[model samples]
Target: MTSLQVKDLDSGYGRIQILSGVSLEAKAGAVTCVFGPNGCGKSTLLRAIAGAVDTWSGSVRLGDQDLTGLPSHRVLQHGVTLMPQGGGVFPGLSTKENLLMGVYLLHDRAQRRHAVEQQLENFPRLRERLSTKAGQLSGGEQMMLSIARSLMLNPKFILFDEPSAGLSPKLVSEALQRVSTLAKQGVGVLMVEQNIQQALQVADYIHILANGTNRFSGTPAEIPSQKDFMQLYLGVKDSFNQDKELHHG
Candidate 1:
């Protein structure tokens, strides 16, 4: 099975370290979610895997291919694509044009046409709005187009950064459902999300990060039983103080 693996990853901007010793695996046909409070290095981890940010130490690999320190474009060539947060779409371009841009790497004219057709078929809503500018679409439709654009490359692994950000509750559910569908279609999905309940609904495995390190990792069924799960969601300081009081009592 194709999988994205990160081992002992350490990375940050300039002199600051954001992620330390981070490790996880996102396997094909499964959704692996990284959940954490803001600034906990969840997004940094995804960026490191996508080659947008440099890794100071450790390694990233896809199946047998070592991807550490590769350029973002090279990572995409190796079947890894990143769909950034807040609908990374060209607002002025027609929906069809945006989708076509994803196939820029495909040299075969026929293949590119076929890929676009497939995406339109998979997202019929997009077909109806092919001529509409991406900015004119609703939040849900814009997000759908973003995801469709990424699929045009036929990537083996996809990294999603805050996919559900800045959407209504209903839209959040719909967006996450689409992500779940990708896993069913045999794509390895690694996502960093703040929507805990919705993320858990689709995740095959969950890893929670806190203070630039892994706090907890387990299946959905196992998460609730973890003592730190609530604490991780709440503030760590409150949980620690509560624990201290109980222990001293």
Candidate 2:
């Protein structure tokens, strides 16, 4: 029943204000998606939550924990993992090496071994490529490796910044399906996505942002297709026209 909460958040680069009063909640066992056009501070929101970016105002809470103002490493230690954009696996590192990197915080050798074994069990595909350079793996496999690496900490909540970027259409579907599966496994997921079509498929709850502020928060089906920005950023153009025709009929 734990949840990640952001309330009355405000942050920006230097004097340039990006996010203003943004707020939302992402609960365990569910997928909460944030969709917005470019430069809307979606990535900044994730960075702030991960403590990668400093927050000028507001707080980030995980259940009872106050995570705001902590450093990035500290946030990860608290079970909030940020999977930044770009296939995050180290290109020159072997698959096993990348996984080992994930457990750098662990002091116990046995514990690190156990974590690696558990992730291999969770992502069997990686086990088969243990000796291969991470860069040599296919894009899909690279993504899996990144997820496995993030899971080495056994995070309660994983923040994804555009997980589907640079993926093929088919891989996008598969990747998003994997994201949904993670939620079902009881991990809270906060995704900042640009692919409206794929995002709509997996989002249990959705938040729309415009100019770095929350514009809407509801279930996917509750989205207002008629809204001008909905059609533009949401890629749901003219669906409202059909709904309007039905209403007239």
Candidate 3:
């Protein structure tokens, strides 16, 4: 089943069009990574989907709900969550309090409690630092908290913008692992990522965006095979097939 869909999405800042006729879909229980160079409107598209920006024209559907032009909170009500590029957290609050705030939309106290317990099970490190102030946590811990907190709502789809930004190699691996696990648990993940290799390693499908439009989209195997796109978008000098043939022979 399709978890989220965007059609002919045209949006941008006032008087400046950043995305023109952008369209894509995130399938249920799959990881779709949108890869692109800088200034390619990657973050802009994410903002448009999350309802942080008004769409000039288009339709955003989460399941059957039309999320176009809805406020961020209302979008969340549709079971779609976005964790923007930066780690969004309350600096003054304890880690546990920050996680609790993520469940604000849940009106049932019992359900919220159950979700919190489940979250601790999913992210044990968070449980260990439950009483620590969010600001005091390391960058990786903050990133984990940011992702863990969002799970409190049990969202159907989550948008991740540069989830690997500002992290060590170990943390990057951990972040990607968590995202992969989320997809396995039936949460659709649409990620805007700069780490092409790592993203491709975990992604079920990949979309390459350039000049505010979708340049190409396919499985990871199709990416490094397209020489022109490799040189143009990702700047790969040689195709993966050539390397594979040499190693095999």
Model 3 residue runs over 4 Å out of place are 224-226, 232-249
TM-score per model over all chains: 0.91, 0.91, 0.89
lDDT tens digits, residue span 1-249, model 3: 756888889988989998988778788799999887898899999889988999899899988889999998998888888897767889899998999889988889898889889889978988999999999999888998999888888889999999999889888988998899999999999999888878888998776666787666667766444465465364243423322211100
Tens-digit lDDT string for candidate 1 (41-100): 988898899999999999999999999999988999999999998869999999989998
13-42 per-residue lDDT for model 2 (tens digits): 899999998888889999999988899899
Pairs that collide, model 1: none
- RMSD values for the candidates in order, in angstroms, are 5.1, 5.3, 5.6
Off by over 4 Å in 2: 226-249
Evaluated against the true structure, the overall lDDT of model 3 is: 0.83
| Candidate 2, residue 222: lDDT | 64
Model 3, residue 28: displacement in angstroms?
1.0
Q: Can you tell me which runs of candidate 1 are displaced by over 4 Å? A: 233-249
